[model samples]
Target: MNAITKDVEMEQQREDRRVEMAQAKDKEDARERERRWQESHQPRDNLAPRWREVAGRDNWVGMLDPFDPLLRAELIRYGEFAQACYDAFDFDPYSRYCGGCKYSRRSFFQSLDMANAGYEVTRYLYATSNVKLPNFSRRSKRNNAWSDSANWIGYIAVSDDATTVLLGRRDIVVCWRGTVTQLEFIADIVNFNQPIYAEGIPTPDRSVKVAAGFVNLYTDKDTNCRFSKYSARDQLLAEVRRQVLRYAEERGEEVSISITGHSLGGALATLSAYDLAEEREVPVTVYSFAGPRLGNEPFKERFEEILGLKSLRVVNVHDAVPKVPGLIINENVPEFVRRAGAAMPWSYCHVGVKLALDHKRSPFLKDTAEASCFHNLEAYLHLLDG
Candidate 1:
């Protein structure tokens, strides 16, 4: 062959090899993508039997739903609005009303007024709970007579529509304030450690233990031991029922209840929603932001059975609160070593449908270190606003 022909032949061979390598690399990339997809979409059988049941349930609500965008948007807006109610409690007793608080500057209720054009806050329901703290020193500089009480367990605002009631639970204010109620984390082993079903509400035939701290925070009793005479959960429910029934009688309209809260408030909201749904037989919906897990498997099962798709939990991907008191607690670990000093063999699980707002998909694990920033109500509000 001539010298030019030899050079052309060599170049042609190099081009052929390059095309072969590209095709091989493409096949490899396709296989890797398939493997990852399979891992994410694992079959139900691959999960634990109990988790299999949880996975099989059709109650989860994702952010991508097309049909219920308006409903989802409203629910999230109400969740953000609920934060204002907590802020209201931070003010003096006289300023606890919506119109008198700083949040009123950018009020969710006012926004509702503008949107509906005639919305009005008709009634405000308030409830408080007091507990005696043996270890909490009364002599501290920060301590006062009211320090032992959680003044705002929650409150319900009855709108002019008569059919809409918004329940808002107060978040933790300070370590020494009423929000300190969450610090009473001793497990109340009742009904075989399963959650004590609401009065007249049938207890499920399951063995699941829940956080007694949360339960006592919600339970109402005649005597004042660990809990007060009236719990925020019980008081809110009573007020809601009274107003709802009054509206039904006076206005001839049935009321629909919606509950929302953040942090410890979210936990109370969950407990309250369960009781309201089971006992009052009202149509109730819940939106919990950065809420901690309230119970074990049985408690979750019961909650799911009662609330089903009516509840949605908004969790930031990096939020740490939702992952704790973890689902698995080592029996051998010391109380101090465990997260939040919750030392149990088994741990709690989250209820309702989870709507995770992931800014970036890092990993499936909850990042405890990122909680301070990611678990804030502002983060949730920002996402919902978008």
Candidate 2:
């Protein structure tokens, strides 16, 4: 009886020890998994102090809450006026007093009604230029005639009460005045694989490369393309810079500058805001509508580093343009096909805070099917109206 009891007691003690050992092992494994997850998710120590400072304040999450009703109304108002600048340049019979023109005046009043604030369009910047069109049907044809491109236009206005200056650029309009002028959608792929160095600042060790097409769209025409007759980017930026400087000097006070555009114009606005902010050392805010991806990851990082919390990219949930030149692509294509020539990058990303508005029901969320209608500036305006 003593031996049997002793054996039973020994077996119970061994089982208890085994259970304790298993629990300890499980705890250690859980801790190790957590450590790995934290290491991957936390911000790296190698980030520049400036980047850290700004990115810390930024909301990196996917979707942000809608702006307050008052602010949203003001932004939409500005956006409409910006679109009006394009119409004024293209359709206004008299360029002077653009605000007086039917198209521009209508937008100006619309903005006033929406904001319930005093705003005046002071200047309209218009340029007639030639843009090169890629022969998509015939890839071999390169030497095409310089088509008369009149769509590049922008406007500078001021809010009388708020004392805010607004710079607005319009998207490309499709029409036939004398000849066919289709908005160019194909990305003119060129080499843009170099670090961007600020004009006056010392070169940082790390830099990002931007897309060549976007660069050309932002850079001075003389440097961009020697053969191109029109220098819309250069002219528009110069005018903006001049007006901003003049306003600051005359008022002897800090002026708030807001740059906005839609679609292709939106890309230009992003580029312009970056350069102006860097050169002028003034806070520049950007609101782009249905804009495409501006540059690669590095370029985006640099832009965020500079603008910080000031930039906001508004996108419609159903819009297609923003998705193109997508950051992710199907990699199953043949190597030779890839090497042959693709203007866009296989992997591309977006920049700044994105506000995606989903107006339609969840069922109609196809990215490719309804892109055309969803990508329109009118669509963005309608969504912003709400």
Instruction: List, residue by residue over 20-77, the lDDT tens digit for candidate 1.
Output: 9999999999998665333322222222322212222345433335424343445444
For candidate 1, the 10 contiguous residues with the lowest summed lDDT are 169-178
lDDT for each candidate structure:
0.49, 0.48
Which residue pairs collide, candidate 2?
Answer: 327-348
Candidate 1 residues lying further than 4 Å off, grouped into runs, are 1-68, 91-148, 162-194, 197-208, 220-229, 249-252, 306-309, 329-345, 360-370
Against the true structure, what is each candidate's TM-score? Answer: 0.57, 0.57
